[model samples]
Target: MSTSPLPRPSDLIARRRAEVAALLATDAAQAALAIHGTPLLLLDTARVEQQFRRLRDALPFVRFHYAVKALDHPAALAVLDRAGCGFDVATSEELALLVDGSVDTARIIHTHPIKKPAEIEHALAVGVRTFVVDNDAELAKFSRAPRDVRLLVRLAYRNPHAKSDLSSKFGVGFHEAERLVREARRRGIRVGGFSFHVGSQLDDPDRFVHAVDETIAFMSRLERQLSVRFDTLDIGGGFPVGYDRDVAGIEDIASGIRPSLERVRGRYTILAEPGRILVAEAATLVTSVMGIAERADGRWYYLDDGVYGAYSNVVAEDVHPLVFAVTELDGDAEQATHRWATLAGPTCDSADVIAREMLLPDLRVGDPLASPAMGAYTAVTSTRFNGRPLTSIAVLSQAPATGEVAIPAATSGVGGPQPQTVP
Candidate 1:
């Protein structure tokens, strides 16, 4: 139950606008114009710090490499850098971003399972020593290079409890992983470690511990057979963040890894690629209702942002977004639900639906809807389908005195500079 009474829809809209107005008051008029009257993502940098501190306190020995692919905005990247975390990058473009952002090149690892030779050469030239490879072909490409670098072999396995429900199509098998490791040794390259990622949004807390245990066993066997030992083990990113009530907490998931950590016997280092869990709950996407229609059988509410924007995942995965409707009320009373709604987007495609059979109160046009857990995949995976523009973006830092969010200046534009925003 909501301890604070919910306001009516008009009051809620008024409050939200007032909040945005005050937050944007200090920002330039251009910033306001760029972000005005559209769906926007708000990121809470403070929450990310809190999560980082929790990890530092719990697992001080391990390093958390923030996956840039999750949400690579410079403002968000600044938050992680200030929090004392490194980066896990897949492409040369991400590496260039880090370099331009003044992030240490040595701290960023080129960890894509498959990397182009030019990318590898650029990474080595730029002082990125660590790279991950999954097969002998990728290893062979790197082995012939003029520069020697630290190589990590990636392995694949099944995790039956992934929330995102991804199966193994990425990593190499155990034997293949061993072959890559041995070949690296034969080529005089530094056999740095092993890595694996159990799918994303995994609810099972023991999944990491279980994979770690198996990995430890595999490493031990390989060491005894090949007479080689690796010093780093990257347990790839699959950390879970709260989406709905059913999503598990970080503490609940990390609690299981302690037992496995105690059993691991090596001078090896442990690391993780955490993307979604760090940014998912810390950000929210705000979109406005553009139109509403009530049919004899159902009700449909259309939003300005659709599958090409905030609801891109719905088009990609056929999953509905969790939407929260806000409203204002009189006499200190909370708003009550009156009807159900099926939310659609402002697109001509028949597949542009956001949510079907969603329950909502009697809502109206121009009312704002918030979808939490949207920070990870929404913005990065957006498209230009139907020539729709990308949503505006903003960052929030906590005010120590007020304990409320203070929205800082953001890089915002519409359908112009950013290709993702061209409509």
Candidate 2:
């Protein structure tokens, strides 16, 4: 339960704005942004460690596996690895990052539900025996696998409201999951447990708890019906972070989950594959307005980054990252007048636009725009669209008092150009 009156969404953004401003105020941040030019990502490994520690403290019973697909910045990985968090890899390349980084392979879990036979073999050869599969064809790949191999059946719990409803692409329903489990047993494969992603950036802690309850209940039912047991329960990552606004607090989400886990604590191994939460706050995207134009709609400021690049989260996830002018961060925000302007990305494709009707101060050409909470999908899912080079990342130093490095508030216009506003 919330103890104090929860801070307003503006308060949350103001807090992040201060953090981002402090980081930008530092000479290091300035130098990096200048040297790297517009459209740069400042990744602080320290923040990654911080977020992981937060998760650990909130849900101490759950083993966290940093989903490598989130940021995958070697700097971020190094921090997480040092913090003793495991890795959850979905692709051969992601697994390679861990192996090449000399991470203990035992600490890795390959959680992609569908994969080529070669990919599975590659992971297995590297000592990653734990994998997630949702279908019979995926299970058949392990018919000749060693007894050391363990598979986690991926279950689907559709959450249409989630930013990314992973269930549509992966996971088996209850009946399909049971069949997959039995099939694994028939193939003489060791079934580890069940796993499900409660959708990306999910806000409902109750939904998270519901998914856990449902999965646990299903596991119990399966154990009784098939006379087999599961050794793990992978609650795939959907832990909400303050993006645009504070979603659900970590403790709030944990409160909903802990009771369920305590009842089954010693009965099974519990795990989580956290992607966005771990690294989302660890990085911020700093872009510069390359050109300002008076478009048919209104004033448009085109930045060096676009949806195909760092702002890919905006286009792909349908989530907007706050955009702020340097004047705002410098504590010289012009409040007397504010105009709603369009922030467009630098791609030839018109769809590359980042945000629309974003309220802002009178921004001039070459003004720096910072987007927080960009450490996650922004970089990993970005592409080299329009021949623009991928954004460069600068690793920041540990400065706990500087400010939190969460995602830029999703509300671009919520507190536009205010000293308390963050991107």
Candidate 3:
């Protein structure tokens, strides 16, 4: 029997383009443009909820915690909270977003391996009971906590292939992990389980499986040697999101690691922190050409938003999100008219280029351009460098009955430069 072939990268790109086109054609999107105009992010809460449900369905036995560091937008948090998903926070500010949203503290986990004593106290004061640690000093910081507090030792499984090798910064190897766990026990701290992140934007499914299997084996061996029984295993979020290409879907990665998790399902609580995969496709960025110039290299188009704004993912995450001109989406621009142009961001810094050698139609000043799969690590990682205000986010799917787009108060840039409508 023959099976249907998987989609090619081009096919995936085409699908994304179609989806973005459909989204831009919506009344909500148009209304957003008419109001907030370019340099805007259209956040679809429905897409966030849908991605959360997909993760749950694919790995039904594992509990998912949305990584708040990916996108701290209130609407995305509200959608995931309403969908009964837990949260994983790395900083107190991220936790504050959840606290302000009135999210249940019991469903939240503080996964930052290193934290200040004051931060720990704040989290504990806010009713967060679970925390993760990778070093003896961090474990010692938790020693004075209440008896009900639980800790998870973070193990590092390095994946050089990942866009970000998270292990390089945070996470412990086998020997250090063993030492931390033992030290936690000696200090009378209850080490409930272990946690690990393979890496961020990792496309290798086997890497996930290997990490899971290795962590489980280590847990079992340590339990036997130390005579301790653990109750939880946190597979920290590093699930990949396809940007300008096809990558392993959540189901594919889940399938590879499910069997390993299934073996210990009854004995342990399996938890996953998913950030990128859940929100990457939930937002689309719309930018406008601020100026056009012919540089020594080639024709250059400067956009209102770039690496320091919504396209910060380009530099921070090392991923290329595809950009399309609005005219191309409307099917008004012909392929023959397209040319390779360098796209630059609206910043005084010469390094503010968004993309180089980009094939785009002859765009003029004020021509609108858009990029999809921008929900994760985009706005959250954005900065106000060169006195440029943060790009405004317009909530698309959760608009009121009157068809008005809702821009979150936190991101509205109330006293900053007002968003100008595209002419």
Candidate 4:
């Protein structure tokens, strides 16, 4: 059967450029950019907290564990921490980041399906009891652990369309999942339940319903066949966040997920790992045009930050961030003319190119370009390629400040955005 193709970016996408433009023209953003210069990320802690509240309101019954891998920024996590949100950590550093923040370990769950013995021990030692495992070797690592540690078998459901096909690298098929549970039983390890990531940035909400229903059935069948009851079902993170175009709304997804989850209520503890949806819109990347060049093909405007920097999301996830010129935001929409330009990063590598055929205003040296929805994997996955310094992040107020804004203290190496004065 032929399926309908996704609408073009312009048609389905929200008019986010105006939002980013207005934000950049704000007195606070301007002052911050003026002081810190370009390659800055403007993060709104309030945005993170708001997103958390939105998810909670949508799926009131499901317990949310903010995926630390999405954006490990301490300030961002602290916002969620204060919002009474739980956490999902995957590595020693991620766990340490939370523990260092003095967050309650009881509220955190380690969800990496495979880990080195040392990593497992590290998380276990730090009061993380709930873990994910998909194979014999992973189950064997927990053999020596305390009986309290509960393991969740990672089940694989391949969806090639997901930004990241997590099933290929992680999770196990049904037979392997059943075998893992049996082995865990043989080794006297407690099996809590099962976990599977449908995929990341999924636009389809019905897929969630299908997966949840399938999982609930599989668990019930396993209980009858293996004489074991699963107590928890982790509907791992796959919630979509809009970037280049609009995807399914969180409420729309919850509508589909809520009914299915109602079937398992009172019997199973429902958990969801939300990474991109919560943090993707909490920040925006601001980069300055370093130089304007005319190559043989066309005009190339080199920006200070590129694929190896804050634009990593573009390269890694194929998420096209809508770029807006600061000039347009300042009510200068009537530029000399608009033309297609090749946006390149400061990196020397050819692959560092950000976008091609970008219809932009005639840009000059030092013109600022802003990309919204940059709060997720962009900064977290960024590299220090070409020895460029990390971009400074500026934390802004929920509402426009009348005067000098307050700067949050640096929580960690990935510091909070410094405050920028509005007046």
Candidate-wise lDDT, in order: 0.70, 0.81, 0.86, 0.83
Positional deviation of residue 380's Cα in model 4 after best superposition, in angstroms: 1.2
User: Candidate 2 clashing pairs?
Assistant: 244-409, 244-410, 372-407, 372-408, 373-406, 373-407, 373-408, 408-423
TM-score, every prediction: 0.84, 0.91, 0.93, 0.92
Q: What's the residue-level lDDT of 390 in candidate 4?
A: 72
C-alpha RMSD values across all candidates: 6.1, 7.7, 5.5, 4.7
Off by over 4 Å in 3: 1-9, 332-336, 399-423
For candidate 1, write residues 30-121 as lDDT tens digits: 24335555577766676677777776666666788889887777766777897889899999888877777788876788778788889988
Candidate 2 lDDT tens digits, 94-173: 98878878999999999998899999889989999899988888889889887898899999999988888999999989
Ranking by lDDT: 3, 4, 2, 1
Q: Which has the higher TM-score value, candidate number 1 or candidate number 4?
A: 4
Poorest 10 consecutive residues of model 1 by lDDT?
Answer: 414-423
* Candidate 2 RMSD to the real structure: 7.7
Q: Output the number of the lDDT-best candidate.
A: 3
Pairs in steric clash, model 3: none
- Top of the candidates by TM-score: 3
